[model samples]
Target: MSCLKLNNLACGYPQHGTKNSELLVVNQLNLTLNDGEIACLLGPSGCGKTTVLRAIAGFHGLNAGEIWLSDHKLADVNSAVPPERRRIGMVFQDYALFPHLSVKDNVTFGLHKLSKSEQNSICHEMLSLVKLEHLGDRFPHELSGGQQQRVALARALAAKPSLLLLDEPFSNLDVDLRRTLALEVRNILKQQNITAIMVTHDQEEAFAFADVIGVMNDGKLHQWDTPYNLYHQPNSRFVASFIGQGVFLSGRINKQHIETELGHVACDVSSSVSENIVSENTETHVDVLVRPDDIIHDQNSTVTGEVCGKIFAGTSTLYTLKLPSGTELLANFPSHLDYSLGQEIPLSANFQHLISYAKETA
Candidate 1:
C-alpha cells in the first residue's frame, strides 16, 4: 500500500454564496506516494500545485473524496488538526529560518518535544544529514544562500516527521546554486529514505529531484510518470510541450510510419496494443513533438531551412530555423560548428523517438 493516497479530492474556496460558487483549485486529484519516494507537483504559476500541498498538509479541507495518510482517514472539516500535530515538516521558498536564532538552535526547536538527550541526538543527526554540522553556530543572515537553504532543510528533517513538504525551496538562489542545492537536497532525502512532496515550477528541478513527477495544468494533473518516460513518451500534447523543449508540428501516420513536414519518423505509440489504423482512415492529423536536439544540420541532407536566429550557449548553439512551409523549429547544434545568421542550412529530423498527439484528443 502507498504511504499517502488522495482519492478524487476537490479543494477550493467558495466565492460568494451560491451552490456553484466554489472555485475549484484542485479537481478530483488522485495521487499515491510510495514509501521513500520523492514526488513533485510541477506547473506554471496559479496552477493550484501549492493548494494541493496545503490540502495534503491538512491546512485545507476537501469538498469531495478523501485523503489517507498510512491508513488514517483525515477528514477534519472545521478545525484543522494544527500543523504541529500533522508530523509534517515544511520548507518554504524564503527558507523561513528564524533570523535571530542560530542554525543549531533552529534545528533543535522542533526536537524540544522530546527528551533532552533525544533532542541533542536528533539535532546532531539532522545537521550531519545536511552537511551543516560545522556551521551550526552561524545565524541565517550570516550564511550564504546555499548554506541557509541547507540549514532550513536540516531544521525540517530534525523533527523526524512522517512526510516532508517543500514549496519552491531553491527559488531564491542563483541558477548555479539552485542546481547544486537541488542535487544535494535530493541526496540527503534519499540517504534518509524520506517520502516527500515538493512543489516547483521549474522543469529542471522537477526532472532532477523527483522520482515521480506530476504535471499540473489548470488545476488538474495531466501526467504523472518518471522523468525519462514523461520526456520520451508524453501522454498528451500539453505534456509534450510542457515537460521539455520542443516545437510541435502537424503530421500524418502512413503504414506504421509517421510523416511530418520536417521528415518521416517510425515509432509506435501503442507498442503493446495490437490496434492498427481503423478502416477508411489513411491519414490522421497528429501533433508531432520535435526537440532542439532532434533536428540535425547535415550538409548532405535534402531538406533545408533558413536560420532565423542563433544563440551560442557555450556547449551548444541554439538555432531558430524557418522551413519552406513557414513552420518554425529550434535546433541545437555543437558550438564548434559555427553558422551565420540568415544562412540557409540543410537540416533533417534525426529523432528515433516520436511523440504524437491526436488533434481531437490533444
Candidate 2:
C-alpha cells in the first residue's frame, strides 16, 4: 500500500524584487512511498529538498499539486490540513529537544490528551524502543549527541504518526557517529515499521538510511531509485556524476561493445548509449562512466598507466593513474600492494554496467 504520495508537487518562494511573482523551487515533482518504507531527498545545499519536506509537513503550502497520505488528502493548492492534524512527525537537524525538560517529559509532551498513566506508559515504551529507557529522567544536556538524537526519534515515534520527516537528523554529529546513528535509527524505524522521509546532503547517510533515494539538483529531482541502481544504472548524466566518484572515459560505440582507452569491453551498447547517439554508428563518440572499482590493477594486463597519486585508506588504497592519453582514472587496490608514484602499473577494465553519454562537440 502507498503510505505517502506527492502528485505534480510544485513549491517555491517569493521573488526578491518583483510583485505578483514567485520563484519555483520544486517543479512538477512526483513520488510515492509505500507503507513502512523509508525514502530520502538527497542533494547539495539550497536544492529545494528541504522545501519538499516542509511542504509535506504542512510548514509550506504548495503552489500546485496535492499531498496525500494513504487515502487521506492532506494538502492541495486550495486547502491544507494544519501540521498538527496531519499526523506527521518531524525530527529536525538539531534534534530539537527541550533543554528544560527531561527525556520522559519531552517524549510525553504530545501525549497531553492521554491520561497521566497512559503518558508514562507510552514514554516508557518509546524510551525502550530507542534504547534510552534508563535515561528517562536525564535532561537533553545530560545526553550525548547520539543519545539526544535517539530521544528526538523516540519523541517523534511516541505519537504513532502515519509518516515521519527527518531533516538532516544526524548532521551535527561527527562523521563516524553520523554513520553509526543513521544505521541505528534505520533499524529502529524498521523494527517499528515506521514510514519515513529524510532530507540530507550526505549521500552516505542517504544510502545507510533510505530504502529509496531521490537525487535532487537545481530544484529538480534527477532520479529516484535504490542506492545500487543510482550508482550503477543512473538515468541521467547528472545522476551519474552526483551519486559517486568516477571519471568519464572518452569512448566510441563499436557494435555491441564500447572502445575506450583502457580496452574494448563488450556491453549492451544499445541501451547504455545516450539517445542522441546511434549505436549502429561505430564511429559515434561517447563518454563512459568509469568508477574506481571498474579499474583493476592487473599485473599481467598489457594496458598500463602511470601512478599519479594514491590515498591509503587502511584496508584499501585509491590510486590515481594517468593514462598515456592524459586521462586520469581512479583504481582501488588493497593497501598491502602499495606502489610508488610514477610507476607504470598494468591495469585492466572491468566494466560491470557500461553507462555512456554522448560526447559534446566544443
Candidate 3:
C-alpha cells in the first residue's frame, strides 16, 4: 500500500477582492508515495514546495481533493487531525530547536506521553541513532550546527511517526556539511523505513537524497520521476534547463539525424522520430542538451572549439568552449590537462543518448 497519497490537492493563501481568489500555490497536485520511498518536491522560491509539505503535514487544509496517510483519508470533513496527532514528523530549515531545552529533553519532549522507562529507553536509542549519544546532556546552543540538526532529526524520529516531512532541512548548514548530512539522513531514514518527503530548491540535494523527485514550476508539478529519468528524459524544456548543467544548441532533424550548426548529431531518440520526418519534408528544430562531461577534449579530433573561460574546480576543470559559429558549450577536463583561454581545442561529444525536444514540430 502507498504510504502517503495526495489527489488533486490545491493549497494556497487567500487574496482580497475574491472569495478564495488567491492564486493557488499548489494547483491540483497529485502523487502517491510508496512505503519507505523518499520523494522530494523541487523548485525555486514561491513555487509551493513548502506549501505542499505543510498541506501534507495537515497544517493547512486542502482546498480540493483528498489526502490519505496509511490508507486513512486526511481531509477537513473527517475530524481533521491536529499536527501533533497526525503522527507526522517535521524537520524545518532552522532546526527549530527550543533554546531552553537541553538536547536530551528536546529529544524526549514528545516521549512524555509514554511511561518513564519506555521514554528513557527511546530517547537513548534516538540519540545513538544520530550518533550524538554523548551530547544528549548538552544544550542546543552548545552543539555545532550539524549536531543540533541531528538532534532535531532524532527528536522527530523518536516519535515513530508514520511519515516525515523535511522542509529544506539542510539549508542552514555549510556546503560540505549539507552534502554529507543529506546522505547520512537518507540512510537513517531508510534504516528506519520511514516514509519521507523533503522540500528543496537544490537539485543536487534532491537528487542525492530522494528516490523520486517532483519538479514544480509556478504552481504545478512538471514531472514526478526518478532522478535519472528527470535528468536524462526530462518531460519538458523547463526541466531540462533546470535539472543539470548544460547549454541548449538548436538543431534541425531529418530522417535519422539532427543537422545543427555544430554538425549532424546522432541520438537515441532518432528511431522514434525517424520515419515521421520522411514524409513531412520539413526540418524539426530541437534543443540539444549537453552537459560538461558530454564534451571530450581531444587534440586530434575534427571538431574545433575555442576556450572562452575556465574555472579551476579542484579535481576537474570547467571550460566554456565557444564554437566557430558562436555557439557556447561547457566541457569539464581533468585538472592535469589545463588549457589556457583563447586556445583552440578539438572537442568531441561523448553523449551516447541525448535528450532533445522538437521545436516547431511538437
Top TM-score prediction, candidate number: 2
The residue-by-residue lDDT of candidate 2 on 1-362, one tens digit each, is: 99999999999899989998899999989998999999999998998999999999999999999999989999999999999999999999998899999999999999999999999999999999889999999999999999999999999999999999999999999999999999999998999899999999999899999999999998888888999999999999899988888999999877777789888878776688864658354478889899999999887888899999999999999999999999999999989988999999999989878889998679
| Highest lDDT scorer | 2
Q: Rate the local accuracy (lDDT) of all candidates.
A: 0.83, 0.92, 0.86
Q: Residue-wise lDDT of candidate 1 within 101-203, one digit each (tens)? A: 9988898987776898888788888888887888888899899988888888888888877889999999999998888889889998999998999999999
lDDT value, residue 66 of candidate 2: 96
Off by over 4 Å in 2: 279-282
Q: Between the candidate structures 1 and 2, which one is better when assessed by lDDT?
A: 2
Pick out the ten consecutive residues of candidate 3 with the lowest summed lDDT: 271-280
Q: Candidate 1: which stretches are off by over 4 Å?
A: 16-20, 76-81, 267-281, 360-362
Residue 194 C-alpha lDDT in model 1: 88
lDDT of 1 at 145: 87
By lDDT, the candidates rank as: 2, 3, 1
